[model samples]
Target: MSDHLVKVSDLQIGFKNEEGELIPAVRGLSFTLGREKLGIVGESGSGKSLTGRALLGVLPPNAVVSASHLSFENTDLLTAPSAELRKLRGLKMGMILQDPKYSLNPIMKVGNQIIEAIQVSNKISKAKAKKAVFDILEAVKIRDVKRVYKQYPHEVSGGMAQRIMIAMMLVRKPDLLIADEPTSALDVTVQESVLDILDNLVDERNMGLIFISHDLNLVSRFCDRVLVMYSGQVVEELVASKLHDAKHPYTRGLINCMPTLNGSLEPLPVLKRDPSWLGAAQIGSGK
Candidate 1:
């Protein structure tokens, strides 16, 4: 078996533009994941989420996807049959999207949603599924499980709704978890709590995580390794602890923009764009 949980080489994702031209959103991106937190950080249009979605074969129908190698736990995601990909999605791999408000069903009760999740891949009765749902709700650190379960997505606060989303994805105990800006919508305290819960669960379950975010500081402190993306390609990669010493121009620019408590109260540095950085060789030889 491969030591890595996920491996991608020369992956490219593009969409059709006006006049039928192919507009590349992600190009020549390559990375490998193991049972640890790996952060993908970039600006709004850097294709961070696209990379995560491609791993699950969940890109939009209009997208054109190609990769020299795209494997998850030895299964080739690039050519996997639709039925096989569906089977792998929730059972072996799970994704937590950015906002719970849009991701969750506004009309469905949270409890029933979770119960459905537990029953989708496993052969379990409603009674057993309810028991499992409650257990998972507790695991995600929901204090008022019963009350929250009975409520609709619109009834709960953003943080609480996010916790329910996490519970839904994790109840299946997938081998790989891709969390795309999971805590971006919550308050500071709530964000920290969610990250703690997620970190603990990943360690306990020995699951590989691809945490996608725009927060460099959070990724530095929370993830074991970090991949810096710029203009749809990985520009640099370094250990999270060594983020301050990043060498790539794009990585350094991102670090310079983050505000520090003791630093000067000056305006944040503006990131300088360079056409040369677009197709440059990524650090760690990912090119």
Candidate 2:
């Protein structure tokens, strides 16, 4: 038994590339996430997003996944029956994905969609469910819940839609949340507000949070720990407060490469990756 809300070990996920060869998207990743928020940072193609999706069993059909140990709330994720996974996903784990355009129903009103998300997890009347939905919206700092709820996905601004997504995902008060670039589509001001909202909700619920992004500076401020991923592998892990002291050359390269407020954008730092990191971990029995 562990205190960590989620644990993963030697996890692997790969898919057939256009060349018809298995290309690993995530390799031998191991980490433990607890009530405090943790950030996974890396450049594009670093497999940060894929790693988070793997935790929730949301990987695509092309993905071939395996793990020695994957558990949430002490239950082995790799072995949990579909029935059990379904129940857990409904009430105990929430995910806010990158694109609400594809995630939300095109024809449904925003309010109905949020209420439906809640009703899917628990038995509640429409009126009670609407109240719960509004409370969540308020928690995320979206005022005029009534107006926004009645509006369609197309009617709301990108930032408003994002807050609604956050609120909807939180309807069940899940113990774990995996936020994949939650604020990428918003303006700078809205991005900061969303970050603050996440900070508050996670603190209030004492939930384990996995925030994935390519932005190292934001992660430094918002998370308790940070994992630096490179070429489908986690090359470094350190306390967020001490992220500047990350040990790996890859981590150093990434930080040195990031753009600064005053620095010109012409020269972006790039890390040189190795090929051997693509190999899969040798699997064992009953993983």
Candidate 3:
């Protein structure tokens, strides 16, 4: 068996305009993921979210996706049938979306939703599924598991709702997990708690994590390696600890654009856009 859990090569995603011309959103993105945390950092519309959605085969109907190779645990994602892909989605791979309010069903109780997910992927009875749900909720550090189980989505706080979302995805014990800005909506303390849960779970399960976010500092502290994207293409890759030493001008510009706690009272640096950076994709050694 290969060491890589997910493999994507020369992946391109686009859409057709009124003129039927292909307008690319993700251009030739390639990388391999093992049982490790890999962070993709870039601004909005840089195809960070699209890349994660594409892997789950959840792109919009109008999307035009093509890739030289896209596979999950040796399963050919590009050619997999809808039934196969559907089965793979929650059973072997799970995705934690950015916001729980938008992702969860407003009418359903939280426990029932997670129980439904558990039952869908496994042939367990409701009793067993409920037990699994509670276990996962506790695993994610939800103290009042019983109360949370009966409460509706809106009844819980944003942080608790996000934890519920995490519990739902993790109940299945997937091999690959995609977290699209899971902590983006939480406050600092809650965000730290969420990250701690994710870090512990990933380490304990040996799951491959694709953490998509625009926060370079958070990614550097949490992930093992980083992929810096620009205009739908990867301009640089770096070891997370070495992100500050990024070679690509775009990466450096992004770092410089961040406001420091004690920064000088000057305007933040504006990134100078260069058309040449969008040429051929640059693959870094990630040293």
Clashing pairs in 3: none
Error of 3 at 272 (Å): 2.1
Query: Which one is best on lDDT?
Result: 3
lDDT of each: 0.89, 0.84, 0.90
What RMSD does model 2 have?
3.6
Per-residue lDDT for 124-227 in model 3, tens only? 88888888888998888889999999999999998889889988998888888999999998888878988887888789999899999999999999999999
**Cα lDDT for residue 254, candidate 2:** 76
TM-score for each candidate, following the candidate numbering: 0.95, 0.90, 0.95
- What total of clashing residue pairs does each candidate reach? 0, 0, 0
Model 3: CA > 4 A from native: 284-287
* CA lDDT for candidate 2: 0.84
Better of 2 and 3 by lDDT: 3
Candidate 2 regions with alpha-carbon error over 4 angstroms? 17-20, 264-287
Residues 1-287 of candidate 1: C-alpha lDDT, one tens digit per residue: 88888999889999998799999999888888988899999999999999999998889999999989999987998777889989999699999999898999999999999988888889898888888989988987789898988999999998889889988998998889999999898888878878887798778999999999999989999999999999888988889989889998888888898788898888889889999998688555322
Sorted on TM-score, best first, the list reads: 1, 3, 2
